[model samples]
Target: MTTDMKQVYAYPDALTEVEMRYCPGCTHGTAHRLVAEVIDELGIKDRTVTLATVGCSVYAYEYFDTDAVQCSHGRAPAVATGIKRVQPDTIVFAYQGDGDLASIGMAEIVHAAARGENFTVIFLNNAVYGMTQGQMAPTTLLGQKTTTSPRGRTAPEAGFPIRVCELLDTLDGPAFLAREALSTPPHVRNAKRAIKRAFETQVAGLGFSLVELLSTCPTWWGMTPLEAIKHVDEQMTKCYPIAVFRDRLAAQEGEQSAESAPGEGE
Candidate 1:
């Protein structure tokens, strides 16, 4: 008798065997897996370098199998810019959270994008700070309650949440910018596609590419894993709509295709 057994899924080679330390309901693990899968699929594991920033993802260096550098709190972009400049041939990327990217490292990211830095950025926006307890982050939604905003985030006092993708869209440096959630299977699949495109943008010598993932911190959000997922789908998406804000490479490809058409303006 012959028996056949098929392997449905397995961990990507781009990820180390280190066990994840994220909370049980947190989505940082999911985001890390997607990025690793993209790196593995692109066959760039050996040439890839990651800048792991502070916040909940401070330990990213332990998860990704590629070479990783730990940057000061909110300084991943600055560090990544230096790495990419020194090693242009290497595929450089930064993994950052809302607290690290949109809060203190805002200037670094803005300047990097403005300068058209050649690198990839994986931004995880979970609305609150996960490392130092549940504090209100720059991307914290209005009326959202956290340790810092126990009474709920209010206007004038707490100010409005910073829309990173839309904010970067106003700049003319980035070659690609997109946002996706990781609440469901379809959403997770789309997130992987966006991440792959971001990496490809860098390989094509395009400008900075950022893919913001709307993730969840169930532990900080005071909700179960399932509730956190639902919150990402039903609530977080309301503030940060999933869409591609920019794609210079795609635009250029379209233009090229149009020019090659058999007939035009006839």
Candidate 2:
């Protein structure tokens, strides 16, 4: 008689054995794992460098096994650009939150994308300033209540939420732009695929690539983990639809296929 074998999931080698500090129901941990999994899958852990931005993602360096740089609020893109320029062979990425990227770092990201900086940007948009006590963020939905907008964000007062993917799509320099949610199992799988594509864009020497992850902050949102997950699907997706805004590789391939069509020579 032979014994049956069982296979189980294991921690990614790209992630360190350090304990995570995120609060209960926070999806930052899941985002981190996804990034780490992508790095492991791509076999780039040795050459990968992560730029950890301020706010909720400030402690990312302690978790990722690769080289990490701690950037000031909204400065991760600028820092990442420098790192990639100096060491072109290394795989560089900046992990930033909505409060850090869409708020204080907006100019940096736009300029970097405009210049076609070759790097990956993982933007975590949880709709609130998680580390700063749930203040209104640039990506916060209209009518959403936050510490700064307790009465609910109004169109006239707060203006509409900034759709980062849509805004970046208008720029001509970025190689890829997409948004993914981390709410359910299917959403999580899609988020991982987007993250992998972002990394692949950089690996192929493409220009700027960004994958915005719609995440959850249960503690700040004052909801249970399940409720927060539901909120991401029901509320956040309304303002920020999950889809690819730009894909240079796919466009190039389509052009090539068209040019080589059998009837083209006729």
Candidate 3:
């Protein structure tokens, strides 16, 4: 320890000491830490619960220091809905990958958001199904290669990459919806902010909230970490376009106060 040097970042107590099983350069572990940090920052570690269904993050319970549940594939949203309803004060969040979320869990997520479930969803979109040996996922980009799609995904065969944020933005029940990237340091910071806001939305009882993170899969993508991150920046962002699709409560209180002021003055 050096007296003059300051530690800019410290491990969150909300995260366990378990070694992550994700491949090198995989961004799932980074995303997990951000959620754990948010829980610690909000002083909700004791009351927070994380749900992991399937895909690469199925062992999420081992890494997060808070309460955790392993749900059936694509069923985390359903489980989270139940938890939040029965124990409304608890902070419930589901950590899901594209294959587990946007594929088999599509109906569950859509209906949950439509019903305005008060919970947060941390979605990881690495463009391929990393757990299943690099198969094409719902978020797979056009012409992206994978073990299942050896010749690259085509429009006719795979349709198109699902823009989840855009799809959910059409619904009115969501309190917040955002898409962010984890390719680099700056982008990771932005992603963390979005994750925090999503959790805040749940805590405020606003409604269903979700943050989609564009991550990397260096092993499955057959590229170095640098190249994978570059691909996320140059290609995946073009398809997903990092943006906050909706925010229900961040500014409404102040705006409502200001609006009432004018009426009172009158």
Candidate 4:
């Protein structure tokens, strides 16, 4: 907060905006910073191509100063796939929400992973769909109330929340799959690392990469900023575990080392 104080780090130049449009206490701002930081760290802001999806956070392109294209609801991954395929040298990524990924964009993501596209995906799972009002999303936990389900999501009708990392890890294409949160100090640090790893994987020419982030929705959840962070750690962590579901890059490195001659390990 002082000029004499050396800044350990700062936001990406690509994200030069006046605060954000997200609700106070919402995790989208943190998530945006994480993505922007990665772009800045890797020096890929110019080459990066971000796909913004429909949702409360659809205006992400306005904040991210890189080349970004807006996509329809639940179609970010599909659009990103084409973009990366055409411009293999470009760093392509998709920013999606629970409603965009777990619910409507499920098929697109599954296929993209199966095909092993070289791109990154940032999935923000906030339980409820915050865009078109608070609706119970596919990632919504059982007994979690939303505008669509005032009585809470019943298992009989809503089924269980979809764990995107766990599901995508089961595929052969996904080179990196991790789930992290921005609820706590430690969690935020871990989340930033995971996001960086995701981008690094793509840069390494590894297949599909996805980082599922557990975020806070203060407005939709009807909680204050401080209370929302606590809820993310307590309630959200239960549904989405914090861990790397898969890492094909490590596996490949191991395999290459094993195949190399003796004393050639890098």
Highest lDDT among the candidates is held by which one?
A: 1
| Model 2, CA-based lDDT | 0.91
Tens-digit lDDT track of model 3 for 1-266: 89999998999899899999999889998999899999999999999898977989999999999899999999999999899889999999999999888999999999999999999999999999888899999999999999988999999987899999999899988999999999988999999999999988888889999999999999999999899999999999999999999988766766777888765855
Q: Can you write out model 4's per-residue Cα lDDT over 78-189, one digit (the tens) per residue?
A: 8988898788989999999999988888899999988889999999989988978888999988898999889999988878889988888778888899999999899999
| lDDT value, residue 67 of candidate 2 | 95
Per-residue error for 28 in candidate 4, Å, reads: 0.3
Q: List the candidate 4 regions with Cα displacement exceeding 4 Å.
A: 1-4, 255-266
Clashing pairs in 1: none
TM-scores of the models, in the order given = 0.95, 0.93, 0.95, 0.94
lDDT of 1 by residue, 125-223 (tens): 999999999999999999999999999999889899999999999999999999999999999999999999999999989889999999999998999
Residue 253 shift from truth in candidate 3, angstroms: 3.4
Clashes of each: 0, 0, 0, 1
lDDT of 1: 0.93
Question: Candidate 4: deviation at residue 109, Å?
Answer: 0.7
Range of the 10 consecutive residues with the lowest summed lDDT in candidate 1:
1-10
